[model samples]
Target: MQIRVADKAIDLSEGATCASVLAEGLSKKQFKNTVAAKCGETIFDLDRLIPAGCDELVPVFADTPEGLDVIRHSAAHIMAEAVKTLFPEAQVTIGPAIENGFYYDFAYKRPFTPEDLEAIEAEMERIVGRDHSFTCRLVSKDEALSLFKDMGEEYKLEIINDLGQDNYSLYSQGNFTDLCRGPHIPRTGMLKAVKLLSVAGAYWRGDEKNPMLQRIYGTAFANPKDLKTYLHRIEEAKKRDHRRLGTQLDLFSFSEEAGPGMVIWHPKGMLVRTILEDFERKEHLKRGYQIVQGPLILKRELWERSGHYENYRENMYFTEIDEQAYGIKPMNCLSHMLIYRSNIRSYRDLPQRYFELGMVHRHEKSGVLHGLSRVRAFTQDDAHIICRPDQLLEEITGVIQFVKDVAGLFGFDFELELSTRPEKSIGSDDDWERATTALTDALESVGLPYEINAGDGAFYGPKIDIKLRDALDRKWQCATVQCDFTLPERFDLHYIGQDGERHRPVMLHRVILGSVERFLGILIEHTGGAFPTWLAPTQVRILTVTDAQNDFAEACHKTLQGVGLRVEADTRNEKLGYKVREAQVEKIPYMLVIGDKEVADNVVNVRLRTGENLGTKTIDEVVDMIRNDCLEPFKRGGMSYSFF
Candidate 1:
């Protein structure tokens, strides 16, 4: 048999495996780090025999990202072995590698506690020390069922029977065996840098109807330094959890009486939401977008026509309205399309952009809902652009620039992804290709690097998704620009072309700050509740040292408010240190320390929440300092500070 490794052809024995070929071609150091092999687009175990006439083989090393994923997946299996060793009654069902880590699901009588996790981790270390080889074998379905049945693994047996395949792959190490589609590491000894993160209860296969199973989440890295860095980031993430910060900052709350996914916006939280909404409206107007609003519910027939009832019915909330069925909208596109069709448009009026901070509803499952990130009801900074086909790439470019500018406003770095057409999409093949090419061209035009997400686009169109990196270097999905060819066709949308003939228009759906509520949650954690002076719900606090300085503090507060600053007077009957401590806890950006000296000098003593003391300054100087902070990102781009 002939095969290719790194574009070099070599002849091997008919039954020779990829491992054997690599051993002949690669240096010992290179072969030592290799964990898997890829033939074209398919990845297989290194021990798998090379197919006849196989071309273009590549090695997957442990030091690479994909290699780390493979290591983590095998680590998950090793963790399963450790669990089964310590608690022999546990039955493993499925385990797979995900982003940054892996998890295994098992059927157990009770939840695994912290102590159980510790013991299981110790057993995993012992197993790794044994350095057993992970040998794979192909077995018949009946054999797999019987093997699991004999071991009392009802979950595994059920999974094998449900598969209904003639053969299944079983990977075994020492005395432990698991059914998996694996390209695992060669040996248990390769899993040196592994950590068990947490154990949570998940329904079998994520279906609540199925029995609950225990899931252990863990992560693995190629080296100890990387593992240490990851652990340090985890600790930082814990300290910056939005839920805890939301309460400590008195921003938002989730009430037991109000529902799990519903958010109760306190005064401070409402202020933050209002500022963000106003900013979005101003930004849309700056970009020549017409603001529009749509009803919360639309007739079910309209939803069915838009393919929502078919492709998205599960996430929608339906209600009967006087013998007619209507669904609460999960997206704002359908309404925007209706607005475009409300009147006739020509090529001169083709690029009609509609903007709305529209509220949407989705029936999110209880388990997936977190503090504001996933919610049953939330508002999107949504917009739609209707333009001629020639203007498609330009419109997409405009959206990409909009996302870049907004991400810059919050000091966030972002990565872009082009999501291609999915298997069950609604558009024609030509339309899908055109839409995808337009998105790809726009990304290239902007000269930003992006990866493709195959079969992960919206049913109506291809999209460019922007994932933002926060202060903790965690990614949050907050912006997307989708180029739709199906919706306009389905809705029969058309405009008069240059030749005065009716032609179909391309529609674009986009959101800069994807969801208003969710974006606020991210901002809270990103800034740790200490937002910039401009976006701070309360920009400044006037803290008086004693009753003697009360009059000066009140006058100072009034002056600050007169100049358009969101200033508050902390005139509580308390000591100066106490007031400062409280302000620090609330994460207020600037504190005006009003003392006898300040009153006598008729100047403000400023102290930053970050512990920087800016000595006394005149009223005009203080105002200029704050006004500059208020217009930071906008100032850089020559954007108007008119909204503030």
Candidate 2:
């Protein structure tokens, strides 16, 4: 058989493997780093024989993304082996490579502890040192079932029965074997830089009804340097975790009594939320959007008409009211459409944008909820634009620009992704194509780069998602613009055309800050709880040096508050240094020091959150300085703000 390796053509024996061909073409170093081979899009294990019609072979290097996935997947199998060796009664279930790491679930007698993880990691190192070859073989379903059944692996038996396949592939290294469709690394020795991260409890198959299993998380890299870099990032992420900072900064809390996935906002947290809401309202109004409100729950029949009952009922909360079924909304679009249809006329009202800071509820699984990021009850900065089909592209572009402006204000760099239709959707093929084309065209028209995300769009239509990259290079999905022709058609929404005929108006469902709670959580982590001057919940804290200065501190606080600044006074009977330290820990943007000297001069000393101390300034000067600081972010975002 003849095959192509890079630019060279080589003739190989009939039973030659991919590794044999690569060994002929690549240098020793390159061949050692090659974990797998790719033929077009299909990846192949090194020991797999080259198919008759195969044309080209591309080496998948260990450092590449695809190669890393293979390495991580093989590492997971090794970890499973280590676990089974250490704990003979433990049964391993599915383990796969996730983003940045891998996890394996084991149905053990009890939850694994931190000490167990250390032992398992040590066993993994020994396995790597043994240099066991990963060999693959095909087996009939009956044979695989008998093999696992005899070994007392009930989970594997259940998986095999559920798969209902004629044959299965099994990968074995040393005495341990696992059911997998794998193109793993050639040997266990290739897994040199690996670390066990943590352990958590998970229900089998992510169903609450199933038995709980112990899941061990871990990661692997091509070399020690890369692994060290990744570990450092992990440590940094711990420091920036929003849930910890939220408590330290006294921002918010969650209580088991109030139920999980519900945020109980503290005063300071609520103040921050209010500031964000105010900014949203002003920005929307300037962009020709009308503020609106809708009822929290509506008739179930209404949801059915809008396709939510059929497609999204699982995530919705439902109840009975007056012998009628009612569903608490998971989205704000239905009511916005009703408002548009209340009374409408000509094309002049075609591009009506309705905005709301609407609160919504979703039946999120308890296991998935994390701080404010994933919550059952939260508010969305949602909007709906009812526009003529001719105005669709312009409307999408406008929303894109709006997202850009908002991201700029927060000093975020973002990326765009155009998501296409999913498997279960409401729209027709033509409508889906048109909606996707409109989003793609809008992105191209603005000369912004974007990648296509396949089959991840909303059930209603295709969308453009904007993911913000924060200070630590973590991405958050904050904004989205979805184009929909299905919802308007479903509701029979129309506008009068110049031709004296009614035409179906297209709808756009969008959110600048997708979930207010989630956005706040991201913001907390992005800024490390030290918000910018304009967005800080408490802009200034007045600190008095002694009892004699308490009255002056009160006056200073009043003056600052009178100027529309969020201010508080630290008049407690504590030392000046202690109060200053407390204020700093709270991440207050500014601190005003009032002492005997400041009182005599009728001035205040300004200390910034960055630890910069400006000399004493008069009250009027201080007010002007803060006001300018408040306007700076708006100016950068190409917007304006007012205190009154």
Candidate 3:
């Protein structure tokens, strides 16, 4: 029998199974470069042989993301096996791979303690040392159900019953069996370095109404050293958690009475937010974006027209007024579309960009909300660019550039990802193809590398998502540029072309700092609450050694404030050391100490938050240093600086 595996043809014996073919290919180094394998249209374990007569086989590699996911999935199963061996009664519900790692849900009576995790880790090491082979078996649905039932595993039986097939598959290792559609690793040893990270309470199948399950989150790596490094990074990330730093630096707070996931920005937090929003507003204006405002609540019909009702209704809030239904807007595109249709447009007005610091409400599940990263109500720096078919590529290019400029200002290095059509989307096939091509061409023109995320785009369009690598090497998606060929059509948006014919305007939906609150949260974590000199809420604090220098400190503070710096004088009845420590704790970028000698010399002693102390320097010189620091990413007023 002949088969094609990743565009290569191979011959196999009539009785060969999928596992045998995979083993043969790997021995010949045909699959060394591959991450996973597929038989016909079904994804299969690499250890499985191609059923002889199968005409197609595709090998998947870890370089592609799906291949990595397969590896993570296998790691999850390994972790589960370790858990069950150690606890014995820890009923495993389901374990699946997520974005960065994998999580296993267990119907345990109590949370797994820290000591329990250590025991599980030791057991997992033992299991991996044994290198038990994972044997796959295909059984009749009745047989599979009977097997799980006899074992008193209700969850496994429930899952098997829901599977709509007469013959189902199971993978067994020793006494452990799992009901899975799997492309798992061949042996336990394949998952070499493993760590069970944490435990949390999660509802079964993510339904809040279902039984709560204890979830164990973990990650795995091909190399043991890589696994160690990943664990170190996780520790580093926790130390820099924004919610913790927010309080340590007196930045923000969340009131229980106010509700979870809502942030109340303190004076310092608000100050930083103001600077960020002001910067964004100016950039938008310079880029020919006309600012617009819309009501928070609109008639429900508007959302229905934008396809949000059908696709995103579950995540939205709805209300009824005067016997008419309304919804608090979850996005600004629908409102902007209505604004655009309020008047007629011509070819000369082809690309109209409307910007808004729009506030949107989303009904986020409480369990999923974490600090400001996931929130219920937030503001988006949203913009919609309406253009003709000929202008689609150019509009996308401009939006990408806009995103880059804004991100660079905050010292974030970002990568691009193209999200394609989702399973349940609104547009026609042709529109999806056209919009995807436009986004691809735009990214290519910029010479930026991108990865495609199949079935992850918005309902109305395909999008180019920008993921920023944070200070701790973690990635966060913060910018989006989506091309919508559907919304304009739904709203009947048009522009008179040069040929005097009506044509639908292609809508480009874009956002920089996707949500102000979330971006601020990232910023807090990235900087560890010590923002750059320019963006710091309080750029400098003037500390005086004694009453004799109080007047001088106040004058110096006024001088710095006059130079457009956020400065305050510490004139309280406190020792100089106390004031200096206070300033450092507050994360003020710079601290200026005024002593009698310095006051008389017209100089100031500068102390950095990182404990760098400089001898007294002239006030002008000190101001010059700050100006240079402020110009790090952009040359403002002919001043510049670099990351070094």
Best-matching candidate per lDDT: 2
Q: Name the runs in model 3 displaced over 4 angstroms.
A: 1-46, 51-71, 573-578, 636-644
Kindly state the number of residue pairs that clash in model 3. 12
Model 3 Cα RMSD, 1 decimal: 3.6
Model 1 error, position 288 (Å) = 1.0
lDDT of every model, 2 decimals: 0.89, 0.92, 0.83
Q: RMSD to native for every prediction?
A: 1.8, 1.8, 3.6
For model 2, give the 10-residue run with minimal summed lDDT.
635-644
- 123 Cα displacement, candidate 3 (Å): 2.3
Each candidate structure's TM-score, on Cα atoms with residue i matched to residue i, is: 0.96, 0.96, 0.91
Off by over 4 Å in 1: 1-15
Q: Which tens-of-lDDT digit does each residue in 118-211 have in candidate 2?
A: 9999999999999999999999999999999998999999999999999999999988999999989999999979999999989898777789
- Clashes per candidate, residues 3 or more apart or on different chains: 0, 0, 12
Candidates sorted by TM-score, descending order? 1, 2, 3
